[model samples]
Target: MPDPAYRPAAPGDGRRCPRCGHRVSRYNDARHCSPCAQALRREADSCPRVHESTWAEPEVQSAIAARDFGALCRLVRGHAQLRQEDLAELSGLSQAFLSMLEQGNRRLTNIDKIIDLVNGLGVPAQLAARMFGRPG
Candidate 1:
């Protein structure tokens, strides 16, 4: 992978993958390219703040930052109108883990895993923000 830091940064340029901050294929528009930005918006239910919040939160300073999956679950549950038990059964994530996530006691270890849950609930990545945070 090329070094994004070494790559030049400029206005209206594709910088890096905000989630992982990796240099995107197109650097002229920044990783928050149209596609990534749309993804972020969807992940937050068209609510950019939730997606934006992680960047400001203590432990979640970046799109790639660790998240409070528990809070995320509550959000998801509300968004999907599904009970935690139903989600647990559908995603095969243990009920305890689901409960932990609802309480913000744990965070997602893998985005793919969260994707599974999201898919099962018919939630869009826009709500998941393929890019977790905007790269500053």
Candidate 2:
């Protein structure tokens, strides 16, 4: 969490946590203080994902957003009411392949496969395409 403007963050902009040296990138980048900043800088390569909505920033943030592959897979199975096995049956792509695609290790190809899954979910193909980066 950078500033309201998404600044790259600076040392003085943070504070240190006595319990942990990690810098909390929240509350407009000024969230953490010094010592924490150092610790965070040292071990701060990971972050959490946002899951409140279907998807956000379909284009610019997707590779990173791809982190939500599991959730998307869940939504496809749960909301669309398609079982992993059933999806496997229909897509001609293995459950493990689907899992990998859902995990972001692989990507979706053959736009029609996406169309099939989206169809099962009852979501419009165009919107699904945007989320999957196959939008025309």
Task: Give the winner by TM-score.
Answer: 1
Q: Model 1 clash tally?
A: 18
The clash tally of candidate 2 reads: 5
* Worst ten in a row by lDDT for model 1: 47-56
Error at 6, model 1, angstroms? 61
Candidate 2: Cα lDDT at 89 = 61
Winner by lDDT: 1
lDDT of 1 at 121: 46
Local accuracy by lDDT, each model: 0.56, 0.53
| Model 1 CA deviation exceeding 4 Å by range | 1-67, 130-136
Off by over 4 Å in 2: 1-70, 80-82, 90-92, 129-136
Instruction: For candidate 2, write residues 54-84 as lDDT tens digits.
Output: 4333432343234343456655555445667
